[model samples]
Every structure is written in C-alpha cells, then in structure tokens.
Target: MVFEYILKQNGIHPQNDLTIDQSIDFGSTAAAFAGGNGDFTVEFEPGATSLESEQKGYVVASLGKDSGYIPYTAFCAKKSYLKENTDLIQRFTSALQKGMDYVQTHSPKEIAEIIQPQFPENDLKTIQTIVTRYYEQGTWKADLIFEKESFELLQDILLDAGELEKRVPYEDLVTTTFAKKAVK
Candidate 1:
C-alpha cells in the first residue's frame, strides 16, 4: 500500500489503462492481501499442502526492501487516546519491541525449523532466505518512521494524482517519541 501510494504520488496509477502494463509484483500473503495485491502471481500457501509451482516471468523481490515495523499502537491512536492512555500504549509498544528482539536474535535456520513443519512442501532454505531478508531490513520502531515515510510517499502520490488538494505536513501525521522511548 505504501508503494502504491508512492506510485500514485509519482502519477503512476496501477489501474490506469495506459499503453504500458507495468505490474507491481507484491508476493501473496495476509498483509499483501489486505493491501490489494493478493491476486499477484506468487503467494504464501496455508499448511504447505500443495505442490509449489514456480511461476515464470515473475520477479521475486523481498518485502524487506528497506524493511521496518511501525508502532501502529502509538501512531494510530487518536490524540485524546494517546494523552489519556499512555500506559496501555507503552505496553503495546513493549510487546512489539519484544517480537522484534526475538526476530533479531533468532537464526534463520531456527526460524525456518519453527515454521517449516506446517509448510512441509516448501523448502527450509527458501523460508530461511525469506527470514534473513526480513531481518536485514526489519526493525521495530515505536516512532513509526517507515510508516511515516510510506504515508509521505503516499501523500505525494495522491497529490500528483490530484487526489489531494494541498501539502500535508509529514511531522503532523506521525509521532516519534514512543520509538525513542522504547529504544531507550
């Protein structure tokens, strides 16, 4: 969705019927599904029950391209909620940090093993490859840096598409304090 927003900022609409048919190859998964890319050629299978078919002509790009986590719990809150529910926000922030810590500390092999039995048809090496790619770009930021960047990129696209009427201050859209607090 971030990339889609960025593309729109650049005046490149995925659904625009232009002479050129450019595809944004987002592989299948739950998030991708929600972001409106679930119909893409590649996707994650549930329970590894089916034979893995290698789809030709599709480029495989890792989602961890500049990967990082957004503290939606902190940034997505209404101003009133943030002001009144700091402790709840902090606890959610801490949980995200813990998950990131686990990912950071775990080896690709271990992670592969953990997820492998459920998806037995897929290769462990492939899973490990995905896990490593995620680790390389991923970080848990309570400040929501990546999400802010994504939104900024999206806003730019919206503006280019004339979907937005004016410039929105990026700093006004997201908070950085929670990430700063969590890191400390």
Candidate 2:
C-alpha cells in the first residue's frame, strides 16, 4: 500500500505509468531484482543492502521516509479484551516505549552489537548500515502513539488501493491512552 502510495505521490501512476510485477513473492523480491526482473524494487533491510553490495540495484528512494508515520509494528486487541486487560496492555506499551527510547538514545553501532545474535549471518557493518538507514529515515516514532494524521493517511492508502470500502474513524479504532501513559 505504501509503495503504491509513494509512487502516486511522486506523480507516477502505478498501474498506468509503469509495470509492477507483484507476482514475485515477498522474500524473493530482492532476488528477482538481482536476477534482473525489474527496473526497481522496494526492499527492507538485508535485501536492500545486499542489492547494493552485489551491484544489482541502487537504493534510490525510501517508501517509509516519504510515507510518514506508519504503525509498522502495532498491537491489536478486541475492545473487551483490552478493557479486561488494561494492565497488561499498559505494560506492553511501556515496554515498547522503552525500546523506542533506547533506539532514540543509542548509536547504530551499539544497537547492531546488541542485536547481532539475531542475525548471525550478517556482519556488524551490514546491521549497522541498516540501523543507520532507519535512524536517518526517522523510522522509529518517539512514542507508540498512532496519531490521527497518520491513521487517516494510512486509511487513504488503503482506500486508494481498494482495500477499504469506507473510512474507519480514528476514534473508532485507535486509543492512544496506553501510549500516552507510557510516554509519561
């Protein structure tokens, strides 16, 4: 949704302006690009770096950077479940805030070292580069609050993509109480 949204924002019509071969699987997109399948490919992390390192493609644009604040990692629960589990939800949001705070305070190299075990195949530099890119792009929001503007923008994207039949009001779906309390 964001990729096509970004394309539209850049004055390029996704379906009319160019060919988008989404037939390629998610994980195989970078590989397909490396194999010379498309002129451009949208990738995350290792895939983007791998493409650049292998000289297959250059990282020209950032969909996230231009897309604005998106709740890339979000927690969802039924209203009843949330009302019943307020304490648990608060703790979870608080923990997420702590991690976000850590990222905001620490350097990319330090973060890379801490998470190195998760990606043993990738070197410290690669992890650092990816972290640096995310940092530079302001990928991590200061707080976990999915604000009104962002929510609406995301809805707009979904609507444009025909994934949503009607706009869902922000108040109807989102509650920033936990996130706000966590930030406090």
Query: Which candidate tops TM-score?
Result: 2
**Model 1 lDDT tens row, 1-184:** 4445434545767568332213544333434434454343333332121212232223344322422232324348788998998888878776766666666677867877787887666677767765654555453332333356666655665675578999888687677666556655
Question: Number of the top candidate by lDDT?
Answer: 2
| lDDT values, one for every candidate | 0.53, 0.90
lDDT tens per residue, model 2, 79-159: 999999999999999998999899999998998899889999899989998999998888888888889998888889999
Instruction: Give candidate 1 misplaced runs (Cα > 4 Å).
Output: 1-75, 113-126, 136-151, 161-163
Worst 10 residues of 1 by lDDT: 47-56
Per-prediction tally of clashes = 4, 0
Candidate 2 regions off by >4 Å?
Answer: none
Instruction: Write out the backbone clash pairs for model 1.
Output: 8-157, 9-156, 9-157, 143-179
